[model samples]
Target: MKHVLLALDESDDRAVAQAETVRDLFDTEHTTAHLLHDFTDNFEGASVGQIAAVRHAANILEDAGIAVEYHETSGSPSTSIIEAADELDVDAITIAGRERSKAGKVLFGSVSQEVILGTDRPVLVCSRRTEE
Candidate 1:
């Protein structure tokens, strides 16, 4: 895989870390990971906190000899992730899942769910937020 987009959120270290693990498993060079924090304004402003998460992931992956680059974009986390993955022509996507309350799921539609349903590329989901 040339590019792998890893979906992340502000309090979601679990998911970002899992995404990096998938990148390692693939042994893909030229790996680029995109994290979409949030969208601001009416398509004009954006708040992408995933940049830090991406950098954190890159450090882990790079130490293992995997090349990594990360991008922070703005928009609905799910929408931004899919768009970025498509833009990058990602071969696959890795995502970490955290527990979401009923309200959280309702408001966000669950990022992991959205990425799995929306993308043509393979998505590796790690269910760890509640995993033992």
Candidate 2:
């Protein structure tokens, strides 16, 4: 079975939407997904919101017959995602990319871009689809 690391943000609708899109496009009955969230705060792992978000994502994958695991960490998002992918020995890393203005992107680095550049494994970046 292939293992996929699904990176998420607990509160962002765009993140959630991208994750759903990733599930729809890539998940299979035999795939195992690790739902991961990274926090900047160095507190206890897995906040309530993070757990809820993971569960939310998990439901989608589980309903599709994919096994799911929840992982949480405190650190740089891109670094944490890469670490989780390596530790879990995932076959690929999936992340949601939000639309950002060029100036915004330049001011604040993109975690997705960093992950794509930093990891040797395959990275699947799903763009946040706009609502009609």
TM-score of each: 0.68, 0.79
Expressed as tens digits, the lDDT of each residue in 15-102 for candidate 1 is 4566557555666565555543444343544345334655566566666666555466655778888888888788877776666787
Estimate candidate 1's RMSD in Å.
4.5
In lDDT terms, how accurate is model 1?
A: 0.63
lDDT of 2 by residue, 12-127 (tens): 56446645765786647768888888878745554624566666777777777877777778878999999999999999888876667977665334787789889999988766
Best by lDDT: 2
Which residue pairs come into collision in candidate 2? none
Worst 10 residues of 1 by lDDT: 40-49
